[model samples]
Target: MSAIALTRRRGRRHSIRRPRTGFLLVLPAALVAVGLFVVPLVLAARMSVSDWPLLGEPSFTGLENYRAIAGNDLVGQALGFTAKYAAVILVVLLAVALGLAMLVRRPRRGVGLLRTAFFLPAAVGLTSAALLFYELYFAGLSPVDDALTGLGLIDRPIDWLGQPGTAFLSVVIMMTWRFAGFYMLILLAGLQSIPDDVYEAARLDGANRWQTLRHVTLPLLRPSLALCTILIITGALLAFEQFYVLTNGGPDNSTVTLVIVIVREAFSFLDLGSAAAISMVVLGGLIVLNVVQLLALRRER
Candidate 1:
């Protein structure tokens, strides 16, 4: 064979082997996904359509569990509360994260330390953070209440988790603190991706800080904002550990979230079929919401 023909023959042989090699490398992850996610999903779907109790054989029920959800008052209350929490957390988290990202985007003295300090709370386990806050909010143990009392701001210590409004506000504050730094890091990356020339051009056009931010900065940060919004919405909607540890859906069950309701059905009420059905509903809602958000926020092609 000619030298060029020999080279072409070898290239074709390697190209044929590449796909096999790639599939071999990906096999482990594919198997893991099938085992962990696909299997459990199939089982949940089966349970959702059956009368599955914690201790009894599962019998097919044909959508009875789903029908039961419509008349369940607790499910309605939990859905409303979960929606309200997601909205509030989405707004607050984005605002706080954007502010932090802007503050740390431009480096100066002690900027790294400031970034670490802001992100430290994110490293703490959610349950641990909730426990810490629970103690801090307790009347006699709370330094906040003590300080307010010492300053004569109130006649008595405020019950942070003992009222519906205060309990909701407290959870919101904890969630924001826990996640603001993580989202800040995301936004900071987006901010840094924006070319400095864009800002300089805006400045040359006599744009002030506010005008530059509104027109130049925000438009460029849409991808990061969308990511943060999606994450915040998902986390808030599926919230469990913090509320479970802190309030236990207390203060007249005002803070009960959808996930909590599902757990209550499965464990507290020993109705696995109902819990599976609720989980399927939550899963469907999440898929729909995420799709809508992605469509809305996707950049024009």
Candidate 2:
């Protein structure tokens, strides 16, 4: 009787394990993510607390780096600039993309060609896009000076990157040109997913197109909009290549992003400790921002 019971139990266990092949298939991916991503991030956290140089054993410094950065004026200014940049870019990207998506949401003449043209720039890498913008704006391809001069809009040709305010605006424009289409794609997908029944109901209720959008469409698109916002905000905060390639943080450190500052500290000055400290702070901020966004999304849901 005991042997028979054991055999039955063994058969049950085999049956249970047999169809878990899909889970087994994912185990390698899980292992690779843990080994490569999780481990390195954990190592970075550990390094954040110590005085680690590129050439020597890291010393146990216990919050010294954090403390130093806390009082540093440059760090504070960089943080302020990063926040400002993120805010400006977020607003512009979301607003423009939403408008574009709404305008081109439906099938229209030449829409396929228009979308292809718009999305092409996003396919270009950040550095390449920035370089292209730099050449365009500086080398007369941007049409800023030409447009102004052609319409008699200005008395003289203006150098967009020669000053702080205009330099910042130039970067924003470059970002907008390259990224608005990407956000448009996300929002456009959300728009396409919305059922026509909802619109018909709105129409039956005497709602105009604007009314339909406000009452039915925008609500359904909340998730995709949130995703775009988070991505744009995060990417803008980490902005480096654009400023580096185009402005080189020039015109009096106007476009000097925090990441650019970190690179200078680490690679240029060979100050690994401060650089690591900056990265640690950046990581902490990103984690906090992501947590806040997640909670807000959960609340909305």
Candidate 3:
């Protein structure tokens, strides 16, 4: 081989080592994903097609569970409730998180303390927060009701989780309180990534706060907003602990969510096949939603 041919051959050989090194570096994570996620997913798929009882032998049930799911009134009702709850929670979460992001985006005296206070809720575990709120809203004996009554905010003790409307609102409120801060942090990072010079240019153009926000900040924040919205929607769809603990899907199963329904099927009623089928449906819906959202973001980019 000529000198140039020999050098190019050596370069090709050296280039091949990089990918080998990368694969070695990623092998552990790939193995972990296969073991933790892919394996369980495959097992769940198998269970979904089988009549796997809590105890006893399993038998193939094929699409029976899925067909039953299609005709199940309880599942329909729970799905509808879940959609409405998710919509309300998504709006509230995005609004609060964005408002917070804007509030603390600029540095002022005591801003650090304000940021800490706003972001503190995200640090609390969801289940723990639900339990804490459960105590505060424990019907007639709740201190919240007592305080509200003492302040004449109500004529008597109000049941925060007794009625359907109140139950839904209670869950939404708790979710907003728990997660708004986390989304705020996400939006804040996006806000900080924007060059200050862009804002200065907007100001120089005599743009007011609302106009600047509408034209500049929102356009720049679209990616972060999209991510936050996707996360909020997914989390809302998978809601369980708050409704499970606070209301127990009570007062006529008004607050039952999709995940709660799945849990009830699998554990409460010992219908593993139905639970697995419903889980697969949820997973499919989530995958479609995420794909659509990601595609839309890509188009915008």
Which is the leading candidate under TM-score?
1
**lDDT of residue 72 for candidate 3:** 88
Model 3 stretches with alpha carbons more than 4 Å out:
1-29, 139-153
In angstroms, the error of model 2 at 35 is 4.1
Model 2 poorest ten-residue lDDT run: 11-20
Query: Mind giving the per-residue lDDT tens digits that candidate 1 earns over 222-291?
Result: 8888888888889989999988988899889999999999999999999999999999999999999988
- What is candidate 2's TM-score against the reference? 0.85
Candidate 1 pairs with clashing backbones = none
Q: What is residue 124's positional error in candidate 3, in angstroms?
A: 1.2
Select the stronger candidate by lDDT from 1 and 2.
Answer: 1
lDDT of 2 by residue, 1-301 (tens): 6999878878885555565797799999999999999998887777778887777788888888778888877777778888899999999999899998987888989999888887788999988999888877787654667788889988778888888898899899999999989999999999999988888888999999888878788899999989998999899889899988888887887678899888887788776777888898898899999999999999999
Q: CA lDDT, every prediction? A: 0.92, 0.86, 0.89
Candidate 1 least-lDDT 10 residues:
136-145
Q: Sort by TM-score, best first: what order?
A: 1, 3, 2
